[model samples]
Target: MKNARTFTTFALIALASTATALPFDAIDATQAYQNEVAILEATGAMPSTEPVAIFPAMPEEEVAAPVIASLQDVSLPAQPRVGAPAAVGVATQGREVAAPSADIALPAVDLAALAETHDALAVRKGEDGEADAMMMLSDVLFSFGDDRLEPAAVALLEDLAPELEGATALQIAGHTDAIGDEASNQELGLRRANAVRDWLIANSALSADVVTATGIGEVDPVADNLRADGSDNPEGRALNRRVEFLLPDAG
Candidate 1:
């Protein structure tokens, strides 16, 4: 399944893989933020290949400002819009991203196994070759911005039993729409993802040690913000607001 949403606007759509037909932003601001350190190093603001101790730390925040400002002169789209939905999903094109290719990797798993054995999940191969999958959590799954899973989500958990029981470990990623302060949205997304994890362990056989959850709010979007009204879209933002599942590194 293909999961993508437009948080700047509430919309959703379901597809099997990254399609040439997708209508999304040419550049995602989330990637820009992730690569900021590289940008800073390239410009000589920070030392070569030396990571800062505190990200967005008080003093770092002041230093990051000028580095971010430098991008304005370039043609790339790095403008991050705030004050949208707090939790959103992820989007992937037809091709999978290899797990070892970068800092964050989502692997590609067997699509049939994921669709039938697990929850409604969209699978992908990371650039680094990690097995990555994503599942779209509807507003009905949990109250808007709340992490607790709903009765409907519980039903889905029952279906997920077999897959979780067999996996070595699992990774759960939480995302949000571009509807609030970035810092707060990140925290909110984490809460929601954790809430879902709590539900699975309480009601199912999965162990806590086998799972890890991440929260990324309003960062990676499959739907462009321009036509978020669904006026010209099918699944606008709902698709973007979701949780991703990935295979863990045994290495």
Candidate 2:
């Protein structure tokens, strides 16, 4: 009974020593126990003190605190807003010109209305003070420096065919610029008027007897033939050289 008890005590001490020497995941637990048994036999007995810490095990994962970055202070230049006026110098024809001010107001003009008003004032009046509507065709519509009709002039007469549908009596008159002699200008004017009258009779519904052709030369002008400095006014001359169509008032 005494030998059995001694063997049991040595076996339990060897197990405790093996468990402390080797880890729980040791590959050869039997070999470690054997080693412990041999040490026990040699030393006879170990001191019964508390077990000391051995190899420290590492954890699976490590945690760290998050760090935030700080922003730096920066300076930027100012930018222009939309619709802001920016001054810029412009070169025109070898000369530097100042741009027109945005604040300046220009007078408004209606060209179509002005033309209608001018034609209305030039209407021919009858002997009894009654007047009829008149149309003025610029000389530019005809060939340059001649009485012969241009293609555009012929087209213009064709367009007027609709307006002459109900007209029974028509009078055609022509004028010239101040640049030419009176006698020659009058003859040229009469020829132009006759050309217009003949065209209307042939192409339109108007009768030859109903249309009378005449010439007033440069006696009447809608614009000045000369400029303020006595220079020839091309615009005024152009306006003066024109054919006038008149519908005489009923007798």
Candidate 3:
């Protein structure tokens, strides 16, 4: 029994040595794993201990205040209001502007009203009591630069023949504008006056002795021959070229 116990003790010591050698090999493997971890950390291949955020924080935006304007800083001209009277020499942008005249004088006689009274005939009182009734004849009744009367004139005179029933005497005066020489104008006026007188004696109840024809020429003009700018006034000249009939009061 002693010999058997000695063999068992020798076997236990050998097994203990084998187990201690295995622990040493395991320690070497642990040191190799630690070295690999140190190399990866130095090369920046290993992840950090703290967790990283996926999104970054944003900065706040600053807001500016709005600016306001005042009406007193603006400059403008003062204008006339609605339905206000117009002022003369109004100041505008350091300049003077003249306003139109409002109080314009109108003509004393309304020719339109007279035309409507009788077949375009304008009748008025004779000046200085030369005659009781004075009738004006438009120059349009005669041709231009001629003493011959137009058909329209004949028709007008036919209508007027009946109105001169109780007249004792009839006087026809012809006037011309300042278009020709004084001698030519005088002759033309006399011829025009004679034409009217002859027509009245032939077509009406008036005798030749009772009718007298005269030529006043351009000396007695009823309108201005020239305008304010020295230009020929066609309208005024047309008004002056006319014939007038003077009749005494029917007694």
Please count the clashing residue pairs in each candidate, in the order shown.
49, 0, 0
What ranking emerges by TM-score with the best candidate at the front?
3, 1, 2
Best by TM-score: 3
How do all models score by TM-score? 0.47, 0.47, 0.49
Of models 2 and 3, which has the larger TM-score?
3
- Per-residue lDDT of 1-251 in model 2, one digit per residue for the tens? 45654774676667656665655643355445456556655565543322222222335476576755444433233364588754444768978666676555333222222235443224433456644335455554567568778887777667666565455567788888887788888888898899888888888767888888998788877679999999989988877878777655333
Candidate 3's residue-wise lDDT over 1-251, tens digit each?
44544554464346444643564543454454345446545655553321112111223565557856568866556686688765657779989887786655423323223344565465444475423334455465798888898898888778766565344677888889999899888888889989988999999877888788999888988789999999999988987887877653242
What is candidate 1's lDDT per residue for 1-251, written digit by digit as tens? 01211321122112213322555422332233337546554655544432222222223243334456465566542343495323322336755443332233334234336655445455554578754565655464677777777887778767775556655577777877666788987888788778777776777667899777788777765555347453543354666667766666433
| Candidate 2 Cα outliers beyond 4 Å, as residue runs | 1-133
In candidate 2, what residue range of length 10 has the lowest lDDT sum? Answer: 47-56
lDDT of each: 0.57, 0.64, 0.67
Which scores greater on lDDT, model 1 or model 2? Answer: 2
Which is the winner by lDDT between candidate 2 and candidate 3?
3
lDDT of 3 at 78: 61
Ranking by lDDT: 3, 2, 1
